[model samples]
Target: MRKFFDPNLAGANLKDRLLACLGALLGIGLTSVISAAFVHPHGAFLLIAAPMGAAAVLVFAVPASPLAQPWPVIGGNTVSALVGVAVRMLVPAPELAAPLAVGAAILVMSLTRSLHPPAGAVALTAIVSGPAVLDAGFAFVLIPIGVNSVILTLCGVLFHRFSGHSYPHRVAGIAPAPINAALQAEDLDKALADLGETLDVSREDLDLLFGRVEYHARHRRKGSTGGFPTGRAA
Candidate 1:
């Protein structure tokens, strides 16, 4: 137990901790507001979306995940939910809907590049929960789920900025592009093939973001340590 809290390895980042708390609080508050205003009978949206929503906001929004973003977070959950509801309403039986719904959600979310894990729950909820959720029909996907994601993302962006952390931090391994151009799908593929190495983003954008983050993290650590900050590399 004592080992768990060792200062050298387990010390908390004050800024990060504060942002996390604020993110969670804002997520809960926003969900509560939506649920209350809508007069949802079960508030299951609150129960399910709150914790998962908070986590999504913290991990994807504040951190600026390469894989997770506002569009992905919101669209993924909403779209997957729509697919699930479609399965439940269109399919023959509840049990069949459950598994089919999950598969449909995953495939769509992946293709759209909005692969949020919790969207699976959203899908299942639409199917197994019966008339209460079914009564929502297609509206359920847009209302609470979409609204909650947008609100949480906005809050996380503000909180992350306030904490002196970069929201939407760039992935370290990728390289930036040489010019800012919206490449077509074919263009992007050609560019990647030209590079002869895989990257998460265009070569130009990657380079720019990496340089900025690398500088900030190293300088901040230096200031915090009150030394040259040896034995470390950003």
Candidate 2:
């Protein structure tokens, strides 16, 4: 229980952790306040969806993640909300609609390349929310869900400039052949194809990580204390 409950996140220091917390607060707080400003009947409409909380975690804590980028954050949540609202309206049976809504949302998110994890919750929220959501119909996709997603993602973009890591970081890409290559760019592509699943990390970032690990391993075995490796070179 203790092991399971303890922080499993690696490589994050106190400052990093605190910044993530602060970013979450700012992103969600502002999303709620800003979204509420224009939309009326505030009681009927939620200022922001609950899934935005999870989105805040990704956008701030793992800003480099492909899923945390602006397109995914906005498209995933908004499309999933559309899916959820559609499912709720079409299917009267709550039990069947719940699973189908989530599954269809996943399918759409995958095809769109907007597979954010919190999108699952956004889809579910549509199924479970009151008549106000269903009554809002397609408009629900734009007003609250879309608006909230845009604001929260924007906050993430602005906040990370000060958080020591770049936001909307590079997506996976092919690296040139190294002088002495153990891993090739094609190898990463083939491996991902064989895995048949999307990883939260970008291929570019994964390439960098593997290159660093290989550099350290080689140097450690040679027992040389040289300057830290910068990055992989062709």
Candidate 3:
């Protein structure tokens, strides 16, 4: 019970939480305004789906996460919407259609390397949004879903850039350190493969983390010794 209530589980500081709040506010506010302008004229239908809220959290709060990147935001949501529409059209039964839509969306996004978590909700929205969404047909994918994704992604990019965070982050692509170095690119890759599960972090980010850790360790050793440690003391 104590382990379950660990304070570490809370994670992130007030500043980070506030930044996420701001990002969600900007991303969703803009999306709602744009979506309402376009859709209100047609009829009363949701311009934005629920998933965009989750996407905003990733984009703003954890910009470095692979799932938060532009491709995941745009491609994942778009592809999932498409899959949802297709499933709804093919399966007449709501029970089968809903599950199939979510599962198929996951598979498609995984294959495309655009696996955003909120996209699964996008898939469900397409299935159960009533006739307004259904009448739009394939247009649903391009208009509200696709448009929403693109707009939010653009907003996230601009927000991250101005907020001192990198958007669409890329790996450092540093060459492997010498043989005597602590860890290498190949070693990291092997370790990842062995884990046999997806990680939110990218390889480059992991490498950078390792580099930072090594740097701090070296500095600490030197500081303790009043100079660089020599021989085995290193």
lDDT of candidate 2 over 138-182, digit per residue (tens)? 877887889999999889889988887888885332344442367
- Report lDDT per candidate: 0.61, 0.82, 0.79
> How do the residues 1-234 of candidate 1 rate in per-residue lDDT, one tens digit apiece?
866543331224545555666767766676557555654454455334533553454353345444355666677888887898789889959878899999999999989878776778778878877686677777777656666666666655666666665555543433233222332335545756887974434344544443445446767967753322111111
lDDT top scorer: 2
Off by over 4 Å in 1: 5-15, 40-62, 170-234
**Rank by lDDT (best first):** 2, 3, 1
The candidate, 2 or 3, that scores higher on TM-score is 2
Clash numbers, per candidate: 12, 1, 0
Choose the strongest candidate by TM-score: 2
The alpha-carbon RMSD values of the candidates against the true structure, listed in the order shown, are 8.0, 2.9, 4.8
Query: Hey, what RMSD does candidate 3 come out at?
Result: 4.8
